[model samples]
Target: MSGHSLENLASFVRDLDSACSALMIEGKNLFAGSHEGVLRCWDSATGDLRWSVEVAGPISGFAVDNNRVYTTASDSLHAIDMSSGELLWSRELEGGSDYVKASNGFVWATSSVYELEVADFIEATIWRFNENGDELERWIITERPWYFDLHKDGGALLGLGRPRCGYLKIQPGEKPSHHQLQTESPVTSGCRSSEDCFLLGHADGTISSIGSDILSDSDSNSLVTDIASLDLELISGHDDGSIRMNGTQHQILGSIDSVTLLDKDGWASSWNGSDTQITILGDTTNTISHNARIRQMHSSDERLVIGDELGRLFFLEAEIVKRRRSEIGELDDDENKNSEIRARLRMLRNR
Candidate 1:
């Protein structure tokens, strides 16, 4: 496949003052959070700045619902009106907020503090909140979670470390349940692969699925950084600059930071942190280079939003990229034809 520049094919581009730390795409709105504590909403179609809001610290993560955008910045969680970008409420969380998710009309967040004595995070807390910012319930666990995701049945799935190197399940209005799986390493990334299965990637480059018998070993010793699924096919990114699809590894130029399935046709994007580029994998592989390392990426259908460490935001349409690739292929073919004609003329002169 031929390589093409992403900047030439992007639908629009925007800039921020600091590194872009978080990104969320909902409907026609694009929400971007920066390391300098600024969250801005943009019109995904036209690249117009709809609104911008400031928080207390660097934005850690974001979760969006029908009417509100939930954000975790430093040790606080802030709720902002989705339409107006107004600060609805803010609440301080114990330890520090690391991840947040929203499902079934409720918001969930996790926080943890590192202990110098133990050289690790000893305790972690999970908080559940209503739309009005009222805390409905909270749970405390012995070890901090290394990964968190929403369960298929509107609960929280937490992958832990150390003493309890398994998973914890938290349902609404119920006690937390711990399930210790027989594994060689801690879970680093996970996602819902199907209606009845949850795929978890391990630090030792193994993949395990809950409620299913699917197990895969990528054979690479590097940590699995991210996992995504398209139908029954599992795609995983590794720290060794490789991406595995059902145990088939494809090596790229740099360590993989994240991997996400773009559509039903098995189109996927894997971010290469060392090269500061995104490799789109499908029938033909193409790369999109960036000015700085990508911090976050989110996609909806054919549209993609990328945020970089230099605080630049790029909105891309997959259709445009496909067209660009075709053009580059045509150009290469023409060059080859021209070279062949020149060679024939030189042979005639020599004869």
Candidate 2:
């Protein structure tokens, strides 16, 4: 490549009409979904739009496994056949979100709900489903969901709630278990830490980690505890660039735009739109910033892809900088444009 210049840029797909939100890479296909109800899969090697499908409503959060794509909209969840672009199944569930994951032979989703039609406080529920689109179970907990993900073994799920940080562990065919952590603030988002524990972003622009042992009760369904459990401790947190506001502010900053775990090693990444900062979760001291406001962060293999509010697509080689980032722990504040730091990154455009 030309030293991270525009020459090595892969390819790009952009639309002035659709606001892109999610990105994924499956095999040689790079996929993106937008608010315009369009979902397209592009060939990673060629940057060609291999296939695209448009549905009735905007696509929020969705996952593709084998030949099926599971998606969630504002009021429903759907299972679609990727090959034919045909709707396989759809369910009417309120509070649909763009946050969905497929693991442990199941598709999982989260949504907010109220006890009554017009209640004030919000409570959220997490649902699990089999690949065939059958709803297995739902776990309703104390607060609105701020974060959710499956454990490493896929045997269990973790959810962190907000207003009051209510944490719960949900396993198939068992009562959801709850755990207490030191964080008592509103949780904005979370992901698995480098150590397999969990990272939770606070409204105050801080990030913290919870030990894996706290999730020990994850698989209560098993007569004997699952071997996936590991003894760990709470990794302290630091200011990850969240700016504190007074009683009144736009309230957009400090919230999580997207989260992805680095594949090569122990690095976990999340984008905070509030201050336009990308934190290497466990190593919160150093962060990255994009020229524009970032709306999503995703990865497949060694490439890290980003989508922004301007309907632009970008791509970077994550593994190239992984070794250097880990060794330095925290990069110097003025190193972003440093020639040595820009070597392995490239952007992809979607026109």
Best by TM-score: 1
Name the runs in model 2 displaced over 4 angstroms.
1-11, 14-16, 114-121, 152-156, 194-196, 204-206, 212-292, 318-351
Off by over 4 Å in 1: 1-3, 264-274, 329-351
Give TM per candidate. 0.86, 0.64
Error of 1 at 74 (Å): 0.8
Taking the tens digit of each residue's C-alpha lDDT, what string does model 2 give over 1-351? Answer: 112221123233344236676667777767677776677776676665566776645567777777887777666777878766677887766564535778645888877665566564366667888888788898776677666767765645454545546467777788987776654555555656454577665544344456643322111111110011112222221233222111111112243344444442222222354445444433333455544566566665666666766555555555445444545333344544552333332222332
Candidate 1 TM-score, C-alpha based = 0.86
Per-residue CA lDDT of model 1 for 120-231, tens digit only, reads 8888999999988899999999888877878777888998876777899999889999897757588888877767678888888878778777677777867888887867
Note the residue pairs that clash in candidate 2. 11-349, 12-349, 12-350, 13-349, 13-350, 13-351, 14-350, 14-351, 61-98, 253-274
- The lDDT for every candidate, in the order shown, is 0.78, 0.54
Question: Worst lDDT window (10 residues) for model 1?
Answer: 264-273
